[model samples]
Target: MSVLNTAEIMEILPHRHPFLLIDTVEELESGVRAVAKKAVSFHEPYFAGHFPGNPVMPGVLIIEALAQTGAVAILSQPEWKGKTAYFAGINHAKFKQKVVPGDVLTLETEIIKVKGPIGIGKATAYVDGKIACIAELTFAIG
Candidate 1:
C-alpha cells in the first residue's frame, strides 16, 4: 500500500543503509503531510547496542523515521527537489510505548507551519494503531 518504496525514497533523500530507517511511504501530500513505515527486525544492527537482552527501538530513531517521512513530503515537491531537510530542533517529544523487533512502525508527519527554509511539523509514530511517540520537529532546508 506504499506509494514510494525504498528505491524511490533514496532518490529523494540522501540516506542509505544502516541509517536509512524508512521502508515505505504510504501516503504523501507534497509539503502537507506524509505517512511512512519502518519494519523493525531483530537483525537490525542497532539492536546489538540498544540493549543486550531486551531490545527496544531507540526513541531517537523513531523520531528520525518521522523526520524522514517529513522529508519525503517536502522533497517530493517541484521547488524543493534535491534539497536536504536538516533537523533544527525538537519540541514536546513524548514516548508512550516501547517499540520492539517484529513491530511495524507507522510514522506520520504533518506540516504545522512553514515559512521560507524554516518550518515545523507535528509527528507521531504508531505500532498497530497505538501511539508510540509524538513530537513537533523543526527543520531547515539546505
Candidate 2:
C-alpha cells in the first residue's frame, strides 16, 4: 500500500476543510488507478442539515470522493501535477446503500480512457465490503 496522508492529498487536490472528503490513499498508480478511504464521522458539517435526525452522506459527495481519488492518481504523474481535474460529467451513477457516520468508505477509481485533457474513470465506493455507490465519471484537466 502506497499510503498518502492528508497532507499529501491536499498537495494534489485543491479542496480543503469540509470539502476534502478522502482521508487516506491505500493504493496509487499515477494516472492509472487508486484506492482511498474516507472515515465518515457524525461531526461532518453536512450531517447537521442533510437530515435533522437521520443524517446520511449525500450521494453526490460519494461521487466527489471518487473523483478526488481519481485525481490523486491522475495528477500524481509528473506531467499532470498542479493541474486541476474538473467534473465534466457523470454517467450511470447509482446509489446502492446509504452511507452514515462511523462508516469507513473505501473509494476506488480506475482511469479507463483518456484523450488530451479529457478522461473517463470508473468509480465505486464501498462500506463494510458492500457497494454503496458506483458511477462513470468524466473529467477535464485544467
Candidate 3:
C-alpha cells in the first residue's frame, strides 16, 4: 500500500553498495506480497570482469536481489521489524534470461508461508514485463 525509496529500504535491509540491488519498492502488502525495482548500470563495479566485451549480470546476484526484496517484504511486517533476515535455502532456481546494463529489473516476492522466525517466499525477476529468473527462497529471522 506504500512505496519505499532506497532510504526507507536501508532501514529494513543491511545491504550496501555493490550488494544492495533494490532501488525502490513500488507495492507492498506487509506479509503477503511485494514488488521492487533495480536499475542496472554500466557503472557497477561487477560489470568490469563479469565479462570482457559482453557483460552479463551474475545469476547468483540476481537470486540475491530477489532474496533481498523478499526480506524487505518480511521485515515490513510490524512484528518482524528490526531483525535480520538470513537466507536459509533456495529451491527450483532458474535463470531464463540474461540481464545486462541499462535494464530495469522488476522484482516480485510473495510470501508462501510464515512460521515463527522462518519464512518461505516465491520470487521472480522481470525485464520488459517478461520473467528473467525465479526461485523459492527461505529465510530465517535472526
- Cα lDDT, model 2, residue 75: 92
For candidate 3, the TM-score is: 0.96
For candidate 3, write residues 19-138 as lDDT tens digits. 899999999888888899999998878889999789999999899989989988899888888999999999999999999999999999999999999989999999999999999999
lDDT of 1 at 63: 95
Assess the local accuracy of residue 85 in candidate 3 as a C-alpha lDDT between 0 and 100.
92
- TM-score of every prediction relative to native: 0.99, 0.98, 0.96
Arrange candidates, best TM-score first. Answer: 1, 2, 3
Between candidates 1 and 3, the TM-score winner: 1
lDDT of 1 by residue, 58-136 (tens): 9999999999999999889989999999999999999999999999999999998999989999999999999999999
Q: 1-142, model 2: which lDDT tens digit per residue?
A: 4489999999999999989999999999988999999999999999999998999999999999999999998999988888999999999999999999999999999999999989999999999999999999999999
lDDT of each: 0.95, 0.96, 0.92
Which of 2 and 3 is the better model by TM-score?
Answer: 2
What are the clash counts of all predictions, listed in order? 0, 1, 0
Q: Which candidate leads in TM-score? A: 1
Residue 7 of candidate 2: its Cα lDDT? Answer: 96
